[model samples]
Target: MSYNMYLSALLMAATCCSLAISYLCWKRRELPIAISYGLGMLTGAFYTFGYAFEIVSTSLEHIRFWLRIEYMGIPFGTVLWFIMVLQYTGRQALVRKWLVATLMIVPTITFVSHHTNEWHHLFYKSMTLNYSEGFPLVTLVKGPLYKLHVYYSYSFFVVGMVLMIQMFIKEKLRMKKQVALMIIGSWGPYGFTLVYLSGVIYMPIDISPFGFIISGVFYMWGIYQFNMLRLAPLALQKVFASMQDAVIVFDLDNSLTSFNQSANRVIAGINNKWIGQPAVQVFSQYPVLLEKIKQGPFMEGKVQLAGHADEQFYNVHVSFINDKNQRPVGKMLLLSDVTDMVRSEITLLENARQLRELNTFKDKMFSVVAHDIRDPLAVLVNLMELMEEEMQTYGEDQQEIVNEMGQQIHNTFTLVESLLEWFRSQSGGMIFKPVERDLAQTIQINIRLLLVRIENKQIHIISEIPKDTFVYADKEMLDLIVRNLLSNAIKFTNFGGTIRLRADRSDHKVVVSVSDTGDGITSDQASMLLQEDYPVSSTGTAGEKGVGLGLTLCREFVHLNGGEIWFDSTPAQGSTFYFSIPTLSEASSKQSDSLRGGRA
Candidate 1:
């Protein structure tokens, strides 16, 4: 009715708009609790708006309208205030619904009582004036329902306040204190209303409307200045930490301001010591860390450290925290420790190595098969040519010639059978049955198997294999690896050159070094031999053909047995292929442990 109430009405509109914007922001973030707080604020505005719009003619009607308007906020403010409690305290209210229902019932009865004699005086008295610019005061009277309204109204306030207090006590104080303060501070509106209602401070205009305006303003302060409801800061901190991210917050002058426990542990670091020290001093143990941070953010690469720790990678995201004046306050170093990622990278590299070695092994097998097949085919062709010559020379004894030719054809068939068997195994079409056997015995078996080829090449075989060594590996896979190695050794070595089998147990594993005096590989070629990919096979010295599956199989088998396989060679000097397998004693009964050791 008056200018002051009109002014309060305008303030309510402004409050509503501002809070709506905040609510929108909160909705965008999917924060239902913050949105509820915003709704609480808007409801307070509606309470004020109701007072400003109604020109009450009497005190009873005035009180009734005011209480109804305030009661409308009961569900919104009461529920939302508890929602805030649930957000901060993670505790739900036990009596929230009852409090809301009681609050709403008061106004509903008061609204309905306007038609009855008992209700008549509750809202208004006798018609004191037909019309007036100002509302009249009522000859106040109270009934049971009026008392109920008063009871519920005060009960609503008490319940809301108590819940807010509980939330304050339950939340992390450092981060949530400002929000608690905002809740406490919002009591100013109700306090002023109480003062006005009790006739403690009488003014021409109702001050309760202004009270809502003030409350709304305080809420805005909480939202804008304090970030009271933004859990994202704390949430992000937790998420990053859980993700194994190392965070370091720096102050204005480039000092280490704050860092999580992980950050301290990640560097050759200490707890608490890094808080006030210069960033350079703290990261001095890991000098490259500063360079990574200085690169702005988001560098995914390896960082070499001084200690024996493995090389790690970091994906850094740097942020500059600014002061209230919008000046740069400090830099935030958010480093996601990608040691696992680095390990993955290393695994990929090893896989490439294994794949290349696999290709080389297949090539070796292909060569061996082609050679064995070619030798037989060549002999068979020559035998046929000789038989043709013999058929003409000794036409009378053709039966003897036919018998010798049949034996030659049978030898060729045997060679073809061996080639086919090896091919099937190389193609993953065959599974090996590994039996635990002495390493010395396996070496002896291979030596005997390659005895004919070794003798034909005129190579001197030197056996320095240990007598008691043992490994649990696929017997067939081991045979193939050793046989191919010896065959390649003999094929490439000069006549009368030495081929040595040096087997020893070292590094908790059986180390087998097969060295050869041959036209060996260069360092560069050797690096790529088991390291990179080239689909085509390189020709062997004896012009053999096939995949180098033997070396690949050896590497794979060594891996399966919890060991390693590699090669060290020099051009034209010699070549040595080294493979190691853990002793059978090392293989555990735990299947998962074995999986990790063998397959991880």
Candidate 2:
């Protein structure tokens, strides 16, 4: 074989192998395959053209055939450019018909006139004769149209190369390793062109042949890596479906872009519709949740599903995604079913409330038991005095002292009974059962409890609580509420001041007010007057010191039984304590003698 024949054999073998590889990869739908195919066509055509030039140096005279071999790659290789990019990147709209036609036809028409005219070259116009030690050697074979063909060919090549480069750059962040493989597949044909033009020949067919070969290998490698790296969309979907919490990702429009299993269920069950729907529409259904779409994509609030049998309460933490200006775009909502937590909280609050009430009960119990015992003790002391006087003559001063002491003891008993009753009402161990009674009659009875002090102060009692009006309240509690109010009013009144009682029905509810003309309570003291267990003790006008709590117990009993008590007063003008309850049935009008708990 001659030198040219030897080179032709190697070139033919390389081209054949590349063609075979190209054929095998033709069906590959991935973007890289398209790139490899383009490289293969360019390389195979370049090598076949080189072989034609070397083996058929005698055939240049048949310009049509020579031109056919010279520019065959121009059309075939150009087709691979966009086709590979579309396949590799999966973008089908890369090249249009007019573009492919212009690239192919212009090169074909120019290269076809290769042999006839020096100035009319497509690839080569004339082959310059040269000598290589008398062996036939060709120097620069310049074609008149060669520059046009070169300019046009390179133009298509550059445009395709630039496009593939752009695609590589765009996906680099996600597939950096794979993109590197694609870069080789895309630019390999150009590498082959570089070796051919330099004439610094290296091996049988230049690197173009091997460039295509390597591209095919890389395509295989990239496919494997795509699967191994878990970038497959199918795998991604499976992972999302398995999540426990509802994970919904939204876009700038506040529309639901995607959601996980839990999120889908929540939206379907609560929102009634969530896919592509605005997040605010579903979230606002709960009363506790104040939908603040005006503020952000997400808001944290309670979900009180009005009629859901589950009665599940959730603490939803809604998140908002906004633009740079803080304008809402989309939202992600995470609902945590905190129903158990809420119930637990309510239970805790109830226990705490009950405990506070119990402490008030303890205060009232001390008031009444002390009185229940002291009342009889004072009577016994009086009987003892009567017995002593019956047995012997008593002195005038001693008798007056005995009578004054007895009176003082009676006052203490009355205050104790009031406080004891206050205690019983605060403890839920005692229930509220209002007994009906004439408002005037109950007042007269309670007044007697304060009679000794009333007489001592020379205070005039003005009973304006109507005789016809009646109050339905726990007999003992009503007595205590009114008694404490009246007792406090009278205690604060000056020696000559009058205690006025007024009871009337206002809006189906009774309003009983006790007004005293004594030095009025300080504005602050009046406000503190109704505290049930926490007492504000002050010295009365007659220098009376309290066991501290009286009205506190009264108010609790009043509240427990669906009544209200309040006080209004001006400093030095006097303070009036008002207590009201639902009027009672006539059947419940009689007082019961049951020991009611209270505090003084």
TM-scores of the candidates in the order shown: 0.45, 0.35
Question: What TM-score would you give candidate 1 relative to the actual structure?
Answer: 0.45
lDDT of 2 by residue, 304-370 (tens): 4444455556556667644445544455555666666665665565456655765666666565446
- Model 2 collision count: 34
Each candidate's number of clashing pairs is 20, 34
lDDT of predicted model 2: 0.57
Q: lDDT at 452 for candidate 1?
A: 84
Quality of model 1 by C-alpha lDDT: 0.59
Report every candidate's CA lDDT. 0.59, 0.57
lDDT of 1 by residue, 339-395 (tens): 566666555665575567657656765665675456557766887887789878876
lDDT of 2 at 574: 83
- TM-score leader: 1
